[model samples]
Target: MWKNKHITFFITGGIAVYKVVELIRTFQKAGAEIRVAMTKTAMQFVGKSTFQTISKHPVQTDLFDQTTSAAVAHVELADWTDLAIVAPATANIMSKMANGMADDFVSTTLLALSVPVIVVPAMNVHMWNNAATQRNIQTLRNDNIQVMDPDNGPLAEGYSGKGRFPSNDEIFNYIVEQTEDVDNSKLAKLRGKKVLITAGGTREYIDPVRYISNKSSGKMGYALAKVAQENGAVVTLISANVKLPIPAGIDVIQVETVEELAQAVQTQFVSTDVFIMAAAVSDYRPVHFVDHKIKKSADSANLTLELEETTDILKSLKSRRTKQIVVGFAAETNDLLNNAKKKLDSKGADIIVANDVSQSDIGFGSEDNAVTILQHNATNIKVAKANKQIIAKKVLEVIVKRLS
Candidate 1:
């Protein structure tokens, strides 16, 4: 996807600046023409000459340097750029971009650009979670700029948290996936739509510390959320217990038990235009709550526990739904199509996506999936096995077509 692309790197003042040095090389290897513009504070961490040596072009740093032959430096650079990436984007630069403040070379050129811009933010965890910073991030998203979600890991402050620079592989893959065929018609249908998605496995507590849960890793739901956001949908993700990097530009609501998940879905379901229920909620819960962890008894050979069925979230929301296209997932070990068809009717869902979880490779915790899409009036669509992101795109294509 980077072949012959005019890509510019805008470096800002951050501890993660040094990490971008090797990242630049990776892009160049993929046939991207790279030029770098650095903030003055960024130069304190990495010198301009280093970038010049690596990119084989003079790094643009000064807003008005008479040494260069160009008539207008920032404007010329902006006109030349096909795509701009702000790596190690500091909180300061992000704030400036959000409010259209351009007092320096980097910010000035960014303001003049007509091409796509990608911002990768890295900062102290406290600053990352600050309300003002978050508001600025939302403003950037509202302005149609793509802001990458920062990774979570060890930081320069000797503690681990969010706001760490993403790995080169993560950034490269994201660029390729999000920018490939940048103007897909299927994706355009999702613009300005409100999508609510559920992910991961809901827990059923047997005691204070013991619970029952599934193996769902939430990869498919996260991929759907990412693609939906890229397609301009305002997305809210209701996530259960899953450890994965949060997708950029999506609101996340965390829940633990089936009851919590049901409540969250009820709160967001009314405002959503599309609701995708991909979470694996436990079928049953303990009849009585045990305040303490149950201990194994030597006096008895076995312990018996009572259980009761949990509320079916999709069925409960059927009456409350208005103009919402509901999608549900049926993960089955046997009779996939029959079970999925039954679910489509019983749950009153507009679509049912079924996949066999008996195969260890393509379902649950895996990164890839193949699904059979079933709808009431439309013909069934079978998507071949592929990465979760690819599967997400196919699933969304079907949804968007139904919307049209």
Candidate 2:
């Protein structure tokens, strides 16, 4: 995906500096041309010669080096780069960049660049949490720079916390999403559209303390919300009980049961341009409700509880939907395509995304997924096993085609 892209990598002093090597190599293997720049402090942790050998380009350290007579070194490099990434961006350098200080090569080039910049911070837990550092990070974000949050784990300070650098694969995925060379017209295809998305699994209560729910982690729905918002949709997320963090710039309404979820969707339906029902609504609920915990008795070892069918949320919306596009999801253990087709018709959905929950690796609670999209009057599209984020992007692409 990164073929022929010009990526400039900047390194700073941190124990996580070693991880930048693998990041450069990953970009190199993807056929991207890479250039390296380092701070004088970064040289202490990783050698300049090491980066020079890996990148096959001279590492820029001195701001005034006259080796390239074409133009100023920083400006020349800045113009050459398609994108800039600062790995192990310490608090010091981030502050400089945030405050428009151009005393060094990295900061000077960053200030001069017209391309996107991605900052990956790595520092001690306390330093990362400090108020001043956070302010600088927010300032950079306000300037439209992409600042990736650091992962939580063991740090070089011999303690476990939230300042560890993320894995190379995660970093690579971010790069791919930001720099795939797609046309600008296709990037924000859903701009000015209002998207309503339901996520997670609804809980059908048996009592105040007990309920029934599914294994849905809400990852897929959250992914769709994120991708849709990134595509310039005004997203409203009606979520169930999922522990994931809410995406920025989304209007979120939290609900716990099927009825509550239905109500929230109905309230937002009028203003929605597109609706995605990604939640796993319970099929049945206990016929009776117990206000208090049921006491266990030794005399009755066998217990039987009656269940009644719950309202089908998607079918209920069919009559109410006017010009809005409706999408649904089906999690079936068998007959995936047939079931999805049935759902696509019965629910009156524009598309039904079906997946096999029988698989151990790529369904329910997993980071990856494989799905087949079923739609009327359109060819079925199958997305092979991949990260949910990638699958979400493909799903949006299909939706864009339909919308256009």
Candidate 3:
């Protein structure tokens, strides 16, 4: 997607400035011509020469650089840019962008550009969570700006949080997705709707240090959440032991055990217009919880654990649902259609998505998937193997029709 593209990096003051150097290199490697515009405070962390050396273009530090060849330096660069990326976009810069304050070279250039702009925010957890910062982010989104959600990880302040800079691969993929031609008419199909999605594999703990989990990477669930949000649904994601970055503008509740996931979903299911159970929840858990890790036996080599059934969240919700459309997923090794049909009937779901996880290429941790959507008295919709995002879009199309 970057081929022959004129991409500009709008660098800002943040500890993650050094990380942008690698991101610039990644774009260049993908055949994009890169230039950088940095704030004066940004230069404090990384030298202008470093970006110049890496981007192979003079870093624009001043809006009025007399040495520049163009009549208006910022306007010239803004006109040249096909895409603008604000890496390590500080809360300060985001506030400026949201409010159209162009005090510095980066903000001024960004304001002049008509091209697609992606703001990658990185800052202290508290600052990222501040009501003012969140309002600014929403304002940018409302203005049709793409604000990439920050990753959840250890922060520079010696603690872990959600304001960490996302990995380069994530930013790259997001750029590719955002650049693709999309049906604008479908974007707001779910306006004013509430969507609740479950993701990842639930972990059933046997002891303090040991547990059982599945191969679910939570990609599909996360994809569903992203697509739902793009369609203007207020999304809530119940994530079960997933490491994926949280999608922007969605409420996320992290869970480990089936019980925890059940609680989270049940809490939100009441007000949800659509509920998607994409999580690979554990069917069973150890009946007895061990406070400590079990030790290796000296005499007997065998150890047995008693297991009990977990709550069937979908079936349990069937009786309580009124206007809500419940979707369930059946991951089957054999008899995919038959199993899915059975689940659709027994679980009383509006839609049952079934996939052959037995295949090694798709399902369970794969980025791509193929699924059959089963609905009562309706022909099954077979979605060919495709990226999880595409699959998500297709699934939501069907759901939106039912909603209409």
- CA RMSD of each candidate after superposition: 18.9, 17.7, 18.4
Off by over 4 Å in 2: 1-187
Q: In model 2, how large is the Cα lDDT of residue 401?
A: 72
State each model's CA lDDT, in order: 0.89, 0.87, 0.88
Measured with C-alpha atoms, the lDDT of residue 78 in candidate 1 is: 72
Q: By lDDT, is 1 or 3 better?
A: 1
TM-score of 3: 0.56
Per-residue lDDT for 1-404 in model 3, tens only? 55556789999998999999889889999888999999999999999999999988899998677445455678667756767899989999999999999887888888887767899999999999999999999999999999999999999999999999999999888877887775232334688799999999999988899998899999999999997886679999999989898888999999989999999988899999999999999999999999998999999899899998999999999788899999999999998999899999999899999999988778688877888999999999987676687678778878988886
Ranking by lDDT: 1, 3, 2
Better of 1 and 2 by lDDT: 1
List model 2 lDDT by residue over 1-404, tens digit each. Answer: 45556789989999888999999999999888899999999999989899999999899988987545333678667755767899989999999999999998888888987778899999999999999999999999999888999999988878899889999999889767765664333336699899999999999988799898999999999999987886679999999999999899999999998999989999999888889999999999999988988777899987678899888999999889887889999999998999999999899899999999888777789987788998998889987666687578778777787685
**Candidate 3 clashing pairs, residues 3+ apart or interchain:** none
Q: Write the per-residue lDDT of candidate 1 for residues 1-404, one digit (tens) a residue.
A: 56656789999998888999999999999988899999999999999999999998889987886433445678667755778999989999999999999999999999987778899999999999999999999999998889999999998999999999999999988777768867524467799999999999999988989987899999889989987887789999999998999887899999999999999999999888999999998999989989998899899989887999998999998899889999999999999999999999999899999999888778799877888999998889987666677678779988998785
TM-score of each: 0.57, 0.58, 0.56
Query: Lowest summed lDDT over 10 consecutive residues: which window, candidate 1?
Result: 66-75
